[model samples]
Target: MTTATLPARSDLGRPIILLMAVACGVIVANLYYAQTLIDVIGPQIGMSASVAGLITTLTQLGYGLGLFLIVPVADLFENRRIVLGSILVTVIGCLAIAASQGPTSFLVASILTGVGATGAQVLVPLASHLAAPEKQGRVVGTVMSGLLFGIMLARPVANFLAGSFGWRSTFLVSAAAMALIGIALLLACPQRRPRGGMRYGEALASTFAQLRQHRVVRMRAFYQSLMFAAFNLFWTAAPLALIRQFHLGHAGVGAFALAGAGGALVAPVAGWLADRRLTRPTSLAGLAGLSVGFLLADWTVAAGSLIGFTIMAVLIDAAVQLSQITGQKLIFSIDPDARGRINAAYMTVMFVVGALGSVIGSATYEAGGWSASAIAGAAIGGVATLGFLLFDRGASAPR
Candidate 1:
């Protein structure tokens, strides 16, 4: 696919950006609605905690597969159609999930839902594609902040909706929200058609080739994998800790999750730094923050310090966003024409591992309660920090 820059005022206005952000938040929100609702969804559907991890794992697996299988198609086809079509699939998946009475159907729907959620990923590149070269980071970051809000708010919003109505209501609402969001995106966003020089088969093949050819793609993928893994671990386990350890009801969990969404606020700042060539230092800070955040959570969870737990939880959340924004900015700059494919390779690796995090989060908590989960999260974060520090050479950042 070839690249062309679009004007800021005509194509990339604040309204368009806002719509993109909202669309991204609502679309990606599908992946996370169940993270906090596992407690509620599992018991009603007859799934054990051991098996509950499959909920996130399957969803993430579907998303990873979509990143590799579907996202790169944007390089060959019209961007808007692919995005809207994915949203349609997401709506179907959400409705199926809402209607499911057993684990088999629900799990199947989870995969479908995850596949559909890649609309948000597609939008990330589309937003990047439309912006002028110098402002791509800021534009991408703004869109990403929407994604982060969806991730952060999905838990609380799902909890609140589920608390008032039922667990199924969350998905029902998500399906509806997506329908509206899809239409808004269709109407508001300018259509960008990639020059159709590459075939689907070649685009898919080149996506994999990006990982082998680009060190930045590989290293950034590895880095975000750790951040995402630890991120999934903490958020997945946190609701259980809140309910069992802190004795908070669904409302309380929703409130805490709402507060935690504050962590996503760092995304714009991360993007800004990335634009200014501060990605290297910001990357280090994010990883170190994750390690420290996990340790602090370890202490706070044991002591039943809600204030402390929230602080550390937000820290972990912010650190993950920090790393992600920087990593994405770096990777996107590797090849402007190949942003779609590079992003697919990077996210596929990161999210597949990240999916495992949910499994570990629930299983570890079940096995050893909050302590084991928190420590494991800390260890993962530390390893990421150390690996980056010891192994990363100075020239990895894009020149």
Candidate 2:
């Protein structure tokens, strides 16, 4: 898909961007709605603490697989059709989860939910494809703000809904909301078909080829993997810490998670920075902030300061979002034709590592408590920070 053959670069006005952002948020929320309900859902379903972590791990694992399997097809299919189909699958998964009678059924539905949630991934590259070259960063950032907000707010919203109704009811409600969003998207979003005549198998193969071909793709993936690991580590374990160490109930957990939603505000700023060609500095600051956030989380827990803990959560989330947007801005600029595959490779690595992080977080929290989880997060963040400082200086941003 050369520039000449590309779809007309239509204006991405505020309404379209807002619709895309909200749609992305609703779709991506499926992956995280289970996180805040782990404690409640685990016991009701007869899962052990260690095994309960799989609730999140499986969702992320399935999403990672979809990134490699489904997302690449965006380069070969009509974008709106793929997105609408994925939403229908998500509705089935959500309904299945609501009706599940045991852990086995619940886990299977969770995987499907994750796979279907790749619709959000589809929209992102679609948004990039629609925007003009000069405005891609801002457009991506705006859409990402919605995605990040969904992630940040899903926990609180799930916690609140589960508290009011039941854990199962949350899934049922999500299914209904997704159906509505699907209808809106179908009517509003324009059809975008890639110009290339590549087969599905070749499209998938070229994703790997891009990985082998681009140093920036590999480095950005590596860096983002570490940052995302720390991100998952903190979120997967923090609720447990709040419940166990801080002696908070579901309401308190929901409130704490709500405070962290403030971090999503950083998405636009990160995008603006990227638009100005400040990705390198933004990346470094993001890494450092992640490292400091973890350390501060440890201190807050020790001091028994709920306010401090909330602030730390905001800092950590901001850092992760900032790094992610910067990485995305870099990758998306590399090959317009391969944005789907590039994102697939980048997110596949990031989430695979993130799945591991969730497991480690659950294990460490069970064994050594909040301090262990915090230290583990800090260590991962430190590695990302060091890697960026030492290696990223030689890398050049795409013009």
Candidate 3:
């Protein structure tokens, strides 16, 4: 069970970064397809609205578990094999969903899909590991643009598919895309397994211990967790408010989805900034934007203002995407050799926090109404923003 060691320099080129992004994008998109289609899924499966939220909850949980459990395998196995194997499993999960006849089956499929989709987390490390140290941010950012694009596009794509062929067929379409994407990755990506291997126990021990002891990892993990909590809170409640309060159709929600897509366009720029020694400012700015966005969301929710709410949503999406890239840049800077495990740990914590926020937001929205929920979300996000400002300022002073 020794871990294989890749060469000091991998044969990864710029084209590979682009290809990896596309492949990972398709894979990551699987986890969010349900987000847009829950309206269809809940009724079709006879689940309560509250319970239907579990689709996202369970998927996030599965993803977090996979990040902690499966992603660390990159330290032991070849990147191509790991990526291919995970894609194959993901395909199976997608088929399970397409064929499912009830909520229970689809729920199981969703969890499995999340586990398989963890390959994107592993790919993040592989791309960073392949690039030159000076170019890590740009490479990571390029790949993340694909990831964020997938995330932003998943909703609109799902809306289209659900509108056209019905919900189950959406799963089938994603399955087909996953298959083609997997083959492309198998064909294009270089093999990166090292000649010598470390024992599995040793590798796992090293990673787990690193997570426990690394100050930077701890700080980044907390930073990502808090930011993602805000992200989850907003997404979990926004659609319900749009549909129930405003009476907008799925298409309108899909259109609104584009704002986030537009905001995510900053991912590569954030990555470029991180590489150029602007990590602190980049992170702080993202957090500030998020805090302001949440406050705006709160104001609109209270005032029942549509235009203001939409603007707030766009700002929130942009800010969250920026924070995500900044966090990744910071994490990748730590212990470059353990990029896979580190990223896995980072994403696992973030998703777990997000899942928790989703649960809290949904409950608060249902019980106290959207205004209360908005206030709750803003308060949590406000604290995280303040923490980031303090951290950024500390980094500026002379030792």
Task: Indicate which candidate wins on TM-score.
Answer: 2
lDDT digits (tens) for residues 135-212 of candidate 3: 777788889878877887899988888888898888899889889988888787767773325666666666666568
- Clashing residue pairs in candidate 2 (N, C-alpha, C atoms within 3 angstroms): none
On residues 48-156, what C-alpha lDDT tens digit does candidate 1 reach at each position? 9899989977997788778888898877777899999999999999999999999999999999999999988889988877776666777887888899889878877
- Per-residue lDDT, model 3, residue 60, is 70
Please give the CA lDDT of all the candidate structures: 0.86, 0.86, 0.77
Could you give the candidate ranking by TM-score, starting with the highest? Answer: 2, 1, 3
Q: Give the distance in Å from residue 265's predicted Cα in candidate 3 to where it truly belongs.
A: 0.6
Query: Distance from true position, residue 47, model 2, in Å?
Result: 6.7
lDDT of 2 by residue, 1-399 (tens): 422233467656778888999999999999989976888899898888989988887887778778889998887778889999999989999999899878899999999999999989989988888888777878888899899888878888887789889899899999999999999888878778776678889999998788899888888888889988888789878989899889998788878888888888888799888888888888888988998999999999999998999999999989988888888888888887788888888888887776677778888899889999999999998898888778876453644
Superposition error at 253 for model 3 (Å):
0.9
Candidate with more favorable, higher lDDT: 2 or 3: 2
